[model samples]
Target chain A: MLTCKDFLSELSDYLDDSVDSEIKAKLEEHIKACPNCWVVCDTTRKTIQVYKGQTECSIPLDIHARLMAAIEKKCAERGK
Target chain B: MSAPGSEAIVSEESGDLALARTGDAQAFANLIQRYEGKIFRLAQHITQNREDAEDVLQETFLKAYTHLDQFQGNSKFYTWIVRIAVNQALMKLRKRKTDRTVSMDEGIDTGEDIVAREIATWDPSPEEQYGREELAEILDSAVQSLAPAYRTVFVLRDIEDLSTEETAAALDLSIPAVKSRLLRARLQLREKLTKFFKHKGDDAFAYM
Candidate 1:
């Protein structure tokens, strides 16, 4: 059985699935047994989901066209 | 099926980057089309203004084009461009420091007052206000109010979904620095969000 500290410490790694199998199993056991730790997991998952949705910035089409033209202009200047 | 010409363009871009380093304008044009958006977004995130972001984007690519020969293969081309944009943004920030006025520490201190005012102004019954979208908006505002250094790391890791190594490379920060800053930023944001919701919840319960 993993301690709460172990679960908390490894939480990020476990969530990222970068932890070893044995530790992962222990962490899972701890989560199953501990409501407090489970809440941490739930909140972290929700937070990440919300964070992902919030950061999608829309790029304008004109910016792309202008950027291309600028890069071409620079290249032309450099070629001379 | 992939467009037959697309592969050629990618290959040509790679070759063009190589040729552009040796002074090839056409090749550099291809490289620009390939990377402009990524560069633009990186600049926009750092500067937080479209006009300044465009300036940084233009400056970064021009600088990158000039210094392309110095790009070692140690990092990806995208990473190199990101570095240039970040540096350019930082330089601009330093130049515009007078406009910022408040230091981050002072900002945080005063921001507490702002938070309090916001809380006070909210309709007394928050339980009646169950807007998940509103909660997200509050969260975004809180994030925006974070110091640029903290905000940058948070956005790179949490928002932009960059891996640790990629973020480290892009920011020229050590992995440990990236990890420390990321955790601290997340903790600060969480604390603010928790307080916001908890206060609302308490108010809602009190009215019941």
Candidate 2:
């Protein structure tokens, strides 16, 4: 029987699909029986999903323009 | 089939890389335009300050331009530059040296029975929460609360959507190490949000 500690230890690798099948079966079994472990696993997975759903932002325009100017100057200096 | 013009862009980028290696500053600048947004965003997230991120942006491309020979085309150009930007941002953080050095083993000692905090499950779902301005702020702060080690891996793996192998390559860690850090980061962020929602009572549970 995989204890909660063991299940938690392998949760990352399990969710990531890096664990072997035999151990994976054991983890699934344990989480099925363990509500706390299930909460840990489910909430962690949901958290990742939520974080991924956040909007993608960019650097400000003036900052980007300044970056271009700065890199251009450095490239120009290298040209000299 | 290939998204209309994706093939052309790839081939064009390859040509640009070739030209860039041969001292074509214009070609290099084109490459910069292609990836500046991604690299800049990565820097901004890692450094968590606009000015520091801007400096990292400047330094990353400057180093890339000067070290074009170092690139061997084995990895995607975006990945290559992202690795550089990560290093640059990490270097800046190191100079500050205040709280940048979060031990990778910190808070990972949950080897006993797990305790489930009274975490309110989201109502409409996290995808729906995307449009809520306050949730966005909370999300950002939740990520910001993580130590740098976990934060960088989370951004690279989850936000940037890099594969585990790619993230391992970028951070120069074993794939297992990447997996562990990512897991811890997710758990910590979840606990933080759970507490936030539990206390607020009405934000995450409004639909319930």
Candidate 3:
């Protein structure tokens, strides 16, 4: 029986699916029996999801232009 | 959880990479186009400043272009550029004197009694509760509140979806250290978001 502490300690590996099946079964058993651990797991998963769902911030046009100009200048210098 | 637009880039990368290495400016520009937004977002998240992020973004691409030959193609071009961008971002962070060094061996408290306090279930779609700009602001501030050490790990591993091995290599931390920091980062971010996401009665509260 994995304690909540054990589950917490293995949380990252568990979520990443890096934990072996034996430990995974124990952690899953712990979460099933523990509401707190379940909530923590569920919420933490959601936290990653929310951040992942964010759209990439578009580069500002001026910044994009500058990057292009810099790249072109570097290309020209390398050409020379 | 590859970043959006990354799949297309990966499929097209071999050709672009070959041409870019040959100093085809257009090929390099195509590569840049594929990754600029993601790199900028990553830079902004790491440096926590627009100006710094802009500089990191430009420097990352320029450095990539200059050192194009150095990329051994062992890793995805995205991963290669990410390594450069992360370095650029961290350099910018250190330049601002806001960087904190966390020991790889430092222990994070995951004691038995350390279960999360706010266990209230969140709205089914907490993200949809806010407007796009508002959600972005909320997320930015939440992530910004994290220490740079934890924030960087989280951004790279979670948001950027870098593999654990990749993240460890990029941050120069031991695999265990990366795992420790990532765990702490995820839990802390979860706690921080709980305040905004926790379900409320009748009023149907939304994240502020």
Candidate 4:
């Protein structure tokens, strides 16, 4: 049986689905019996979910226009 | 996608790519339009400042356009572009003298340093019932608190949804290296958030 510390080391691969099936089962079993480790794993997963859900802010219209205009200027220069 | 053996291939991405490669500025602009917001978000995440992130975003496209011919088509165009943006973000961070430059192995040095601490799990969970704006603020700070090595991996892997191999390739780290850093990053973030979420008003979850 892996200790909580041992589970901590491999928690990422286990969550990532990168762990081999047998080792995954063992880690899952450990967390099931261990609330501390379980919270650690669950909270981490939710944290990632939260981060993934962050809204993507659009580039302001003026900045976008300036970028396009600058690129257009460069293209015009190449044509000259 | 054309029929497997057909000579005529189609995909606006590929079509735009072809034109962009030939110095067609409009085609390149089309490509940038699709990706600029995403790349800017990535830059903003890593540089942790709007000014630096914008600089990275602009420089990434300028560099990509100048070297468009060097892009191999083996990867999706956005994937190729994102790799460039990641580099630019890192360069901007380094220029600020704020990059932590530690690999997972070197960063942890010895795993023994992380002592276990008891933490209360919030009954309502964080994303539930927490005001959306406040949660967003906390999430941003938590991510920003990570060292550069781990934060980049977390952004690329978790937030950007880059595959492990793709994240590894973009960051020039080995597959195992990427995995380790991402794991460490998540653990540290979890630890940070546990403290932030533990103090819900008692009645908020009395029903549970």
TM-score of chain A of each: 0.75, 0.92, 0.87, 0.87
Per-residue accuracy of model 3 over B11-62 as CA lDDT, tens digit each: 7888999998887888888989988998999999988888989999989998
Q: Which stretches of candidate 4 lie over 4 Å from their true place?
A: B1-10, B97-109, B113-118, B199-208
Question: DockQ (Cα-based) per candidate?
Answer: 0.30, 0.52, 0.74, 0.61
- The model with the greatest lDDT is 3
CA error at residue B7 for candidate 1, angstroms: 11
Ranking by TM-score: 3, 4, 2, 1
Over 4 Å off, model 1: A1-9, A54-58, B1-13, B98-140, B190-208
Please rank every candidate by lDDT, starting with the best: 3, 4, 2, 1
lDDT of each: 0.65, 0.77, 0.83, 0.78
Best by DockQ: 3
Docking class of 2: medium
Candidate 3 wrong stretches, greater than 4 Å: B1-11, B98-115, B201-208
Scored against the true structure, residue B46 in model 3 reaches a CA lDDT of: 82
TM-scores, one per candidate: 0.70, 0.83, 0.88, 0.86
What's the CA RMSD for each of the models? Answer: 7.0, 4.1, 3.9, 4.7
Per-residue lDDT of model 1, residues B70-100, tens digit only: 9986776766787788778767766786647
Report, for all candidates in order, the number of backbone clashes. Answer: 0, 0, 0, 0
